[model samples]
Target: MSDETNNEGLNEAPWRATILTLYPDMFPGPLGTSLAGRALENGLWSLDILHIRDFAEGKHRNVDDTPAGGGAGMVLRPDVVGRAIDAATGEGDMRPRILLSPRGKSLTQEKVRSLKEAGGAILLCGRFEGVDQRVIDGRNLEEISIGDYILSGGELGAMVLMDAVVRLLPGVMGKVASGEDESFESGLLEYPHYTRPTIWEGHEIPEILASGHHGKIAQWRHEQAVALTKERRPDLYEAWEAEE
Candidate 1:
């Protein structure tokens, strides 16, 4: 049996997301498929895909132009991107507006947690060199980066950010605890997970797992997760220390 939108399930909270991109069709096949798709298909969320080119001037539907001052890559026209943003969030109320740029502030779990408000969100996916500076400044949008590296387009970055934040919204996950214990949830890497076999080809399950001491096992996992995070991402460890 499949839950292809049951009437009772429609009663589940459905969040709304509006993505402003030149390539709306790029999405949704597999990229944001995990939690994002389930949220959309089951009516847990509604995704509004807006094509920036649709709002363009001519038959060419141009959305970008060469950057002024002579840059290697073109800069997306400010007016086009800004108009798309406005359409997505609407002029009614203020929402957390995000401009995806490689040079922007690095995305983080805490940042994702901050946008958990039930209000709608608008994501601007820039292409070419980047969106025009005038657009970013004029909109006063918060800039976010998935990592230090650069990608050809902002659509992938937007999807990553959207998936992360949307899952945090209330009622997205079928299981309430799904997002609560994942890696980075507690500023720590996730502890290892085990499944049914108990014993694999060359290894046996950890003895403590079979000890039945639930409290002790839980404490052990937390300590291990913290240690792993400390080893892998020193930045997270430093932030944890600052908080402590």
Candidate 2:
């Protein structure tokens, strides 16, 4: 639990996130701005950062070493990372422990929702080559990948994951519908939106949107969402169709 004062005064516990990373300063980067930041201030959620280097021992304070069986880069030492994990999660903490890696399970909106329901997470950001496999296995860290591409480090992935989960926290967004109607929430890309201008350059807002009939507007939005999904993301469309 965080010591930060809660302005909202909610009786329930705030969602907690403990981040274990070599670069502790990278966190709450974008998370400290916008809706997520406001939520943090209101004590809807909390963030704790643990510097991996803090757990290193010896005069030089080394936290990584050359990979076993000969690899090109250094691997985070199992002993050091294990110690950090232990410190982050005291006895009997049920919150999921996650390791951000390219090889991990692909992250999705469904997974994000599950994490939010779990109330909190312990995130491990790997660097250099990667964390020692022994530590990853022994600690039972659930590996997660944000996308198929490679990143310089896992800090950005952790931020992305947190951003997705935090927005769904109670009172984070102004309206419940705001999060519900987003892309992937219903297995389709969201329909295009238009604003007061009504016309932008040569383009005009669809006439149906201006119509007052609620049923027709809902139907139009669903059709547009389906069409857009089929064109832009056939894979999602296929899965949605299968379930239907």
Candidate 3:
């Protein structure tokens, strides 16, 4: 619950988030503008980019150490990362901790919506090799990945997840309808949309779409969404069909 009540005496506060990363500057730029920026400016969501290097013990200020068993790259030390998370979360039991790792659960729009209801989470962006397993185990962090591929670091994935989650925060989106109408919102692909001209290069838009018969148009959209999903992503189509 939030303190700022509206004319209806309702206080719908935004989600509160804190990010623990070695590269703090990597986060504040794009994250500081657009929708996420507006959310921060409005206090709909709060983000603290706690630098893991700040907790480093000594000179060189190294947050990562060479792999113990003769591996390729240096892994992030648990001590530095653990300490940073502790500082931001204040040793509480309720704080949500997330490790952005490729081995974790696949991220989905439904999952994004669910995480929004959770009041945000702490995103741990792993660099170099990866964060020490001990930190993840000790903190009981949930690991989530955007897809099946690997990237240089978790920073991009963390940002993607944050953007998805934060936009759902109250007041973050200019129009709620916009988010609701996006792909995967209805467990199906978004209906085809066209702007202006209606006919470009002689590829005229579908006549049924422009017919304005609301019921027929809605049905056509549903069929298109289902058909598109089946053609493009049969896996999603399979899951959607199983439910029905």
User: Residue 157's C-alpha lDDT in candidate 3?
Assistant: 88
- Give the poorly placed runs of model 1, Cα more than 4 Å off: 1-13, 31-34
Candidate 2 C-alpha lDDT tens digits along 1-244: 1212223435558899999998988878999988888888888999999999999999998999998899699999999999999999977799999999999999999999999999899999999999999999999999999999999889999999999998888777766777789899999999988888988898999999899999999999999999999999999999999999
Model 3 alpha-carbon drift over 4 Å, by segment: 1-10, 91-93
Model 3, 1-244: lDDT tens per residue? 1222122201566576788887788876676788777667767777878888888898798888898889798999988888888887864536578889998899999889888888778888888878898999997889998999998888888889888887777766666777787788877877788767988998988999789898998899899999999998888889889999
In model 1, the Cα lDDT at residue 134 comes to 86
lDDT per residue as tens, model 1, 14-127: 556677887778877453466567667667667778999877888787888887888697878988887877777654656678888888999988888776554566778878
Candidate 2 off by > 4 Å: 1-9
Give TM per candidate: 0.88, 0.95, 0.91
Instruction: Check candidate 3 and list the clashing pairs.
Output: none
Tell me the whole-model lDDT of each prediction, alpha carbons only.
0.76, 0.91, 0.80
What local lDDT does model 3 show for residue 1? 16
lDDT of predicted model 1: 0.76
Which is superior by lDDT, 1 or 2?
A: 2
lDDT of 3 at 211: 93
lDDT ranking from best candidate downward: 2, 3, 1
The window of 10 residues in a row where model 3 has the poorest summed lDDT is 1-10
